[model samples]
Target: MKDLYYIFDPLCGWCYGAGPAVTALAEHAGVRLHLLPSGLFAGEGARPMNAEFAAYAWSNDQRIERLTGQPFSERYRSEVLTNHQQMFDSGPATFALTAVALTEPLREVEALKALQHARYVDAVDITDIDSLQAILGRLCLTGAAARLARPDAQLEEANIRRIGQARQLMQQLGARGVPSFVLQVNGQSRLLPSSAAFSDPHGFLEQVLAA
Candidate 1:
């Protein structure tokens, strides 16, 4: 058996671009996927959306779309990025994923995919708790939705711990960003090159299996 640690941030466009490869790896029988939310744009890291930031993010999003074939719709730009009322925060989404992780562990990636789609394609306000809960409900992840509706100390702690673990792993591996993949086999762990996830998803999986 192998353990694959996926370190990511829910709000990171690059991480969203890597979704297909990560989902494929999660489905593999021999791999145990542990999603660690890096809290990259959560809490104190959160920033209010401004014209300058919106332009920068849109530029980056376009590049990701071109490279990975992921859709960064105009709707997302107009609705999500241009809305200064909503802060650019991933805390709520990360917390919601934690709820899924605690309840329907196997469905956590599914939840992440759905949330990404909701924001980037469907133009939903994913930073909102109500929106997150609604998305979970649509996914038939009611248990997670319930946990999110009334967050407890356990959920909060677990979320923090997951982020802490992800950051620690990043520091240990000298990884500078999200979408970092670390493969563990035979009790040894090593960071996998993240480029293949966007450039050659099939090759990335083959490499993981071979390793």
Candidate 2:
């Protein structure tokens, strides 16, 4: 089976922009997706955001919105972007995603969608365990909370290994940023376009399929 690895962080804005294209590619190709949770905003979780940083992120978000036509509502701005108290770390959400992957490989994409919806649409803080658990519950993933809390030794080891593998994949593909898509076939790898022309999702998927 062909493999398409999507290395991304749930909290990544560009990843959200590329969401439609990625979904189309996965569905059309019927390829197995390996969701590698890159710790883009990892570290000590939340941090105080100064005016300069806030301005930069908001401006970038505006550009993304204009480019992709993805909705970035005023509620999301007021609740998540403007609110400096909430942490922007992607670690907790990534780890929970890893846990979901360990339990059921097929559900990785679903878990990713749920996490993204929680963060972007619902304006929920995904860095918090409670918020993640609540979203998992809505998905009927009852064991997600326990798996995230006390990950089995083997699953923990696998998650760590996957993280390292994702870093190596990033290096191999020469990806410069999060939400990168790499197509590997017959032992050869190719880097798909970044967030250049996101409005044409089918065009992007064609490039991936060709790769």
Candidate 3:
């Protein structure tokens, strides 16, 4: 089996852009797709969504939309970006995804897709536990939400390990950014070119299989 790791941050605009390609890769046979949250936007990296950051994010979002045909909505622009009340933390969403993995591993990616859509499309504050839980509940993932509500030390350790491993991989590959891919086949792992993800995900899988 091939293991493909997509190192991402929940609040990253580029990661959201790579969503469709990642989904396609997830569906490929003989490939075990692992969603590795880097937590890059969590902890000390998080910031308040000020007007300056909002404008900058919107500019970058437009580029992502052009490149990947993903969405950046008016609601997201007005409601999410303009709201000074919300801090840009990836921790809650990361935990929520971790919760999904703990309760229903197969639905982890499904949870992530919903997370992205809620943030980028529906303009929801994904950094809040209540909002994330509500969205997960609507997706029929109340079990995951329940797990999220009562996260134990084990879940925290799991989140740390995931981010740590992903950071190590990024360091090894000299990749500076999120939305990076590492394809592992036959016990050997190598970095997949970033272009393969955006330009041709299926062909990228074929290339990895052939490798």
Candidate 4:
């Protein structure tokens, strides 16, 4: 089976923008997508954001919005980003994603979609354990707390390995960002997009199939 590794963080705005493209590639290409949680903005505790940093991020977000037409809700702007107290960490969401993968391997993609929707659309605080548990319940995934607290040893190991693998894949494919695509066919890997773009998903699939 051909593999397409998608290295991304759940809270990444670019990944949110590329959602439709990722879904299209997954559904139409018959490729197995390995979702790697990069844990961007993770590990460090919440840090204070200066005015300069906030302005830069918001400006960049505007560009992303213009390019992809993905909604960045006013609530996210006013409630989450504006408040200097709340950290923009993606670790908790990434960990919850890992938990979902461990508990329901088959539903990983759907779980990711649901989680992203919950964050970007519903304005839910994905970093909160209670919110994550609520999402798990909605997905009909049981024992999420146990899974979150004590992930399978082997699965935890694999999750760590997957992060390393994703970084290596990014280097190999010369991809500079999350939401990049790489297709492996007949034991050879080919880079798609060369750069990130919301358009031309079909072109990417064509290149993959031809390769």
Please name the candidate that would achieve the greatest lDDT relative to the true structure.
Answer: 1
Write candidate 1's Cα lDDT for 1-211 as tens digits: 7799999999999999999998888998977889999999998989999999999999999999999999999999999899999999999999999999999999999999999999999999999999999999999999999999999999999999999999998998889898899987777778998898997778788888888
What is the C-alpha local distance difference test score of candidate 2? Answer: 0.75
Candidate 2 deviation (Cα RMSD): 2.1
Task: Supply the global lDDT for candidate 1.
Answer: 0.94
Per-residue C-alpha lDDT of model 4 across residues 16-104, encoded as one tens digit per residue: 77777677667764678778876656666335556666677677777777877777777766656666765677777777777777777
Report the CA-based lDDT of candidate 4 relative to the real structure: 0.71
Pairs with steric clashes in candidate 1: none
Candidate 4 at residue 13, lDDT? 79
Q: Which residue pairs collide, candidate 4?
A: none
Query: Which segments of candidate 3 are over 4 A away from where they belong?
Result: none
Q: Which is the winner by TM-score between candidate 2 and candidate 4?
A: 2
> Which of candidates 3 and 4 is the stronger one according to TM-score?
3
User: Per-candidate TM vs. native?
Assistant: 0.98, 0.89, 0.95, 0.84
**lDDT of each candidate versus the true structure:** 0.94, 0.75, 0.87, 0.71
Give the per-residue Cα lDDT of candidate 1 at 104: 96
* Model 2 regions more than 4 Å off: 44-47
Better of 1 and 3 by TM-score: 1
Q: List runs of model 1 lying over 4 Å from the truth.
A: none
Which residue pairs collide, candidate 2? none
Residues 1-211, candidate 2: write the lDDT tens digits: 5578888878788888878876776676456667886666766433555566667877887888899877666676677777777666777887788778877767777778777777667878888888888888788777766798676887667767777777788888778888887778888877777654277887876666565
Location of the lowest summed lDDT over 10 successive residues in candidate 2: 43-52
Give model 1's TM-score versus the native structure: 0.98
